[model samples]
Target: MTSILIADPIPLLNKGEQALLEGIVESLNIIFSKPDIMLLSNYPEKDARRSRIPVINRNPVLFKSIKKIMPRSAFLLEGALMAILARFGKQNFRRLFTRSELWQAFLNSDIIVVGHDSSVSYDAVIIGWLLNKPLVIFAGSIELFRNKLKESIAKVLLKKVNLITLREDDSYKALMDLGVIPGVKTQVTADAAFLLKPCSPERVKEITQQEDLPVHDRPKVGVTLTRQMCERSHQEINDVNERYKKAIAEKAIVLDEIIERYNVEIVFFPHCIGPGKNDDRLVARDVIQLMKRKDMVKPVVSDLGASELKGLIGQQCEVFIGERTHSVIAAMSQGIPSICITFPSDRRTHGIIGGMICQRDFIYNVERLNPIELLTLVDKLWAERPVIRKKLEGIIPLVKERALNSARLIQTIVSEKEKSDNGYRCPSSQH
Candidate 1:
């Protein structure tokens, strides 16, 4: 069994994260005939198990204790290794506990497929390089979290990496600024989110009814809370509310206006939920209070799983207004036009634009947003919905195309390791 190890965000996390996880997992299982080990982190064995394919769920203890540790990646890897060791009878030593032990895990594997929507650990990248294995990063604006120092580290990691496959042109440029070299091997692919198909009418109807969503022929709008901020713990709710007050207030007004002008119906989608947090409810409550129309609908309050949530979004909206990139992704996948009201630090708007997407896809700096400008864009997007949908149809096919190409990059890197393990080529070293 040419074992390939997958490092991805698991579905139990949130809808956007789940969508990425589901898409990546299904792709690997279908594309690779070989039996593999998927090192599942942050989720339990039962939670990570699949239906048909056999996969080993390596339990880790350290990850459970990974709470705001300094040098986050080191802590993440340490936590994972400790957790894995605890599953056995062994105690984790501080030092094969060395990088060498981690290298062996990578070298023994035929390939390593990193996240399409996952947070790639520094350990994963470093060890993959040490093993001289093929390293491929599948994602959108994967650099969103990295700063200058981290970007330097990423450049070094890219040295032995086979490819850094980004779904957005702007992200590719972001990588270049960080030192990713330009070449045929450095791929700019479309987001895998587009590969998710629309739900069957029965399935859609089921979820729509289950969520208490409106299903009439009236024009509807989708509203997905920010996936990252949405899934934080209950303790974080007050913090988000205080921090993002202006943006939320601005958005509430936009929704109210759209409801008045277009008679908008909404599927109030929540992307993530931690132990006791309900961000969507908070958002939904705020929006409801702000609205002038009771006819503007909202989905019922309950934790909808990732698949069901996507189905609900797919069926309910003609367009979406979201804070999360993946929420916009859900809207995009369905050929439903969306506008991302982004945070100050987010570069996703630029990335989507690089793919030839227009400004209608996203707007940046919502924290200091001009209400008039935002409302104007909303009205304009509403007016040109059909034209935008037509363009998205052409864009949708690129999702799978990019994924397949990304898979090929990993295949080439893994194949080369069989010939020599002296050193691997850096992505920067390519043409």
Candidate 2:
């Protein structure tokens, strides 16, 4: 059996990352008969249960542990310290690649698929080198580096991957601008989550029953906002504490207006349920508190798996407005109209993805995040839901095909490696 290990899946906390892992695994299962798969995550039990794969819990490296101990305000300082340490030599870098669980899983696997949804930090590339294995940067996006020192480190590590497939044109350009090495098999593909099929109807019924979610007669609007993005905006903008306050407060007002005009029920989907600031449930509730019609807004904070959450969104929501890329993806894949709200420095993932289905009608930057403008956009999108759904119906399948191609590319790469090891074709070829 071919053993494949997925690194940095982070399935439990963030639903978008979960969708990517599941989409890839689903493709793998179709091509390979019962391949051995292992996932690495911080929340092993939750991830394993959700993905239906054995998982190894990855421990934080010394630097990461130290960084975590510091207050969030010092994140920039921690990043600088890490960059300085990384520039010192490979010894500092190798210290991060020596986790026991990560090493054990890498040794047991034939191929490594690194998630690109997060930043390209080069940890997986280093681990791949230690095991002398080929690795792929799965369907994800990367930012164009503004810092030269970090860019140097990123370029060196990114080039080591066996294959690099990015989700959008902007990310592809970012990789090129960062200087990808020649002869590295690189291509542009849609995000793996774009291929995500909803959960079974039976499972959907089970979830709705267990959660006791109301079956609203009016249109249901699904919403998700990430606390991380809001906090990051706080750091980036000037006198923005008031602006951030207004953004959330204004969001509530917009929703109220939307409810009044369209008679829609708002359902808040908290994709990240991790500890501390990562808990989106808190943000969802806070937004509800700011709303005028609190009775019309409901928060779904249950520990639902990614597909189940997507299934719920697909089944109940007439339209979605989410800061989380995956929540919007879940909505769009099911032909639900969506509006993706992105902040500054967002690698253009939201704009590119939303444009594929709804043109620019559904993509909004958070810079102009105000009640009046948002209400206008929401009204326009709700009015255009039929046309938007029609566009999504045509686009989603093509995106899925592109996502599955990543898996096929992996098979071809592994097959060629085995062929070169022996004079004849590999024995596994017939399967």
Candidate 3:
């Protein structure tokens, strides 16, 4: 059996990340016959419970435990010492520290796939490179690094990857700017989340009824928000918090106008619930508290999975105003018109919504958020919703095809590797 190790520390709380993981897994299942898959996780026990696939900690258990009590300098020293031991220690010495399991998993896997955009995935890429494992970065959105050191490191790491499938044209262009050319090694694809299947209509209805979301009584307008809108700004800590409060207040005003003018129920989808201040639920609560019409607004606080949440958005919403990329993608995939609220430097929005979906005009930068402008755009979307929906229907299939193309490319890489290793060709190649 072919073994594949996914080096993403899957955060189950964030629905967007969960959607990416599920879509990638679903796509892989179509290409490989029950491939033995393992995941490296920060919350290994929780992730193991959530997913059927085996999960392992990114670091050894003892080191992780020791990290809590050790001082920062000591911890760094210990980490360096452990690395040397793992690399050069005698077999029994390494076995004594339980370093074998982590190293063995990396050594045994045929390929390592990175599905996240964070530093955790970059660390995995470095390790996989050192081990000489086939590496594929799937559906990533790469942006130009503002830091020279980071840019240099990214250039080095990305240049060596077997395949790098980007989710947006901006990312592909960014790679080009960094001298990573578009060839056999690099290609543009759509986000993996586009292939994630939503829950059934029956399930969506059940969720609506369970959450008391008045989806049946009125036209529902789905909205998503995140704290990053303020945090990502080039401001000091104090300024960021103050700006966040102002942004939330402005959003409340916008939602109030949207509700009164359009006679629609505002459903707040907290796409990322939290590990910290990044929680959308807290932001939604603040927005709700500041709004005049609390009865017209409902925040989804239930623990719905990514697909289930996508089902609710796609099935119940007439129009979506989303800050989360995946939430907007969900609405778009189902032919629902959406306005994307994005951070100033978020290339994913510019690339996907602007370039692929052809809805560049609907994207609003949160840093320069104007209620009047947003309301005008919302009015336009409401007026032309039928046309917008029709346009999306025609466009979504092609985007989905592009999304699935990443999976086909993965299959090709795996098949070619297998053929070279075993001197046997794949059945698909026979045709």
Candidate 4:
């Protein structure tokens, strides 16, 4: 069995992250027949094992100690401190690298697959180098974090990765700006979740039945809203509460108008569910409370797997409007009309993905948002649903094909390594 270690993914919290993990596992299974795959997770062993997948708890001793003494409300501060340790300092960095469990996991893996959501950590890259193992970074955005020290360390460490696959144009440009690593093979591909198969007809039927979702004779819209648009844990905004109130009020108004004008029923889909402050379930309820016509909206809080939820959206909704990128991705993958409400700071990932799949006009920047403009676009989209669906039907398949290219690349790299180690040469042309 080819052992692969997946790093830097919290598979149990956000559904988008869950989908990315599932999609990569599916691809690896297809490529290696029987690969032994493990994940580095911040979640506890018992909780992480609930997925029935092998997981290594990645919280180092320092992190555990921090959590033990720190109050729950200071979680974000704890994260900032951890980030500093990971990037700024030498002592904590050595402590992380010297951890026996981390080194053991790194040494055991035949190949390391850094996840599809963010860049790999410097420690992970260093471990890969120390072991001389080939690493493939799967699809995701890649930009330097706010820490310049981290950026410098990452630039040096990333050079050792065998292949780095980027999922969107913005990340490609960001990588170019970061300067090319001499030996790393870089490729652009669609997000792996694009190829995620939908839930079975039976599963869809079960979900709708359980939720008592209206299937026909009425227009239905799926909406995903998160606290990400309104607040950040560490950042200070002028009158943050007032900003949230304004945004929430605007969203509620939009929802009400859409229902009033189009006679559409709205279902709020919670994309990220957990105990965290940014839990989508909490934000969904907050939005509902702020709405004038709360009766028109219902929050679906099921614990369905990622693909299953995507299937529900495909089967049940006429259109999807999401603040979360993956919810929009799910809708687009299934040929449903989708709109992404983006934050102004997100100049890359959101716009690039939506522009590539849907038209550029479908991407909305929240900072410059106009309620009337959005309502007009919604009405237009509804009017032209057939044409949009047809376009999506043509686009999604090609994107899926591109997604599979990442899997093919990993297979080729692994196969060549096995042959060379066994004293057999791969044909010169194959190189």
lDDT scores in order: 0.59, 0.72, 0.78, 0.72
Writing each residue's lDDT as its tens digit, candidate 2 over 1-431 gives 88788865565667777777778788888777789888877677767777677888664343466556764423334333333333343654534433345554554566778656755536665655544567888776777667989889888878778888777777777777777845578887677777667889889888878777768588799999876555544344576466557567777778888889988888888887876777788888878898889988888879777888999998889999888888888988888888888764665555356444545667777765666777788888888889888988898888888878788888887797676632111122322
Write the residue-wise lDDT of candidate 4 on 210-315 in tens digits.
Answer: 8777666778899998787755321344777776777777788889999998898898887788767768888888888988887777788777678888888888
- RMSD (CA, Å), candidate 1 to true, equals 7.2
Model 3 reaches what TM-score against the true structure? 0.87
Superposed Cα RMSD, model 4: 7.1
Q: Which ranges in model 1 have alpha carbons more than 4 Å from their true place?
A: 8-11, 34-39, 45-108, 114-118, 130-132, 140-151, 178-185, 227-243, 275-278, 353-364, 417-431
- lDDT ranking of the models: 3, 4, 2, 1
What's the best-to-worst order under TM-score? 3, 4, 2, 1
Give TM per candidate.
0.75, 0.84, 0.87, 0.84
| Span of ten consecutive residues with least summed lDDT in model 4 | 422-431
Worst 10 residues of 3 by lDDT: 422-431
Model 2 spans > 4 angstroms off: 9-11, 60-102, 229-241, 422-431
- Tell me which residue pairs clash in candidate 3: none
State the lDDT of candidate 3 residue by residue for 57-149, as single tens digits: 665444555666664343234434444454566655555444445555665677788644432266666666655567888888776688999
Report the C-alpha lDDT of model 1 over 1-431, residue by residue, as the tens digit.
55666544354545566566556555555565654655544454534432123333333323344434544455346534533432332433422333333323443556666545535555666555444456667654565544777767766766555667776676666666666666425777656555554457787787666766775788888876543433232233467555455455555676777788887676677776553453566667665666666567674577655566677777677888777676677777667888876654455544653343554445645544666787888887888889889987877666566655655555566567666654322222222
Locate the minimum summed-lDDT window of 10 residues in model 2.
422-431
Better of 2 and 3 by TM-score: 3
